[model samples]
Target: MNLIQGYDPDTLRELVDERECAERLAEIESQRSLPVLLERVWLLKVLDRLDEALELAEETVRQARMAGTRKDLLRARVLHATVLQNRGAHAAAAQELAHCANEAEGRGWFGIAAFAHQHHGRNAYEAHDFDVARESFKRSLFLRREAGADDTELEKALRAIDAAERRSAEAPGVLV
Candidate 1:
């Protein structure tokens, strides 16, 4: 499986074999393509090598900005924001994701918008802002529908909403 397939997109948590990720990383170690770089960033992140992941993510963003398409740049930015979120730089991640989502939406890139919203939702969820998380997830779901996203994507968005709802209900004195 691909490095991305090894993680849950919304949560950025590993969902498959770590050895598989290692093998994939090894397989692509000699590559410098944007796609390869992106996969390396993801594999390093999932493997808990945050330092390497962050460094590679930044390089990937630079590469995407310099030589890749707008969609590629946005995707790189989103992944960079995710790494920031994972590193506990929640505010920075939120700002970057919001910008990415707005840009993607303005450009009619509904799929990317959905991805940004989903990750933004996860950031909010981690920060204990369940209402924001739920709203973001709802927006993601809507965007995914607009983009004709597959069932797996839609279901993930739905699950994120449900999780936010549950968390909101559990938190003391929080009204969602």
Candidate 2:
């Protein structure tokens, strides 16, 4: 098994060598622990290996629920929702994001809540529900700011909010 030594998820480099990361993760995945597996799943997502990520993400969620902490479960769920959204499974993704958002909010995990709201907004945006998307993105930005999240993440959320607002403004008169 290929053990990915020396790569810390919390301190992941600004510009990751994703292919190398993925290769290293894959080398030891079968022998890896849950945390490493989860990181691998995320790396695969970054690599746009959605099918593989989705498969591993599902298993991660199941394993997390079975033996991991609540935070672990939340992470897995967020990953699952991301894969679903990337695959255009908007409704399912929305459901997962809503669950994650509610749970994170209840736990005062504002950063996770912000992430969920951001993805929820993306799901709505994909569905053409501009008004709902706009609201969701606004909520996400507010939560992220309150959480003192990274500036880059805040900027991305702001961009999404702007796009949603633009769409809402341009949408024709039709009952939503």
Q: Please identify model 2 stretches exceeding 4 Å from their true place.
A: 1-31
Whole-model alpha-carbon lDDT for candidate 1? 0.90
Query: What TM-score does each of the candidates earn?
Result: 0.93, 0.77
**Total clashes for model 1:** 0
Model 2's alpha-carbon lDDT is 0.79
Model 1: pairs clashing at backbone N, Cα or C within 3 Å: none
Candidate that scores best on TM-score: 1
lDDT of 1 by residue, 1-176 (tens): 54445445345355867888889889999999999898889888778888899999999999999999999999999999988988999999999999999999999999999999999999999888999999999999999999999998898888889888988898899388
Per-candidate Cα lDDT values, in order, are 0.90, 0.79
Clashes of 2: 1
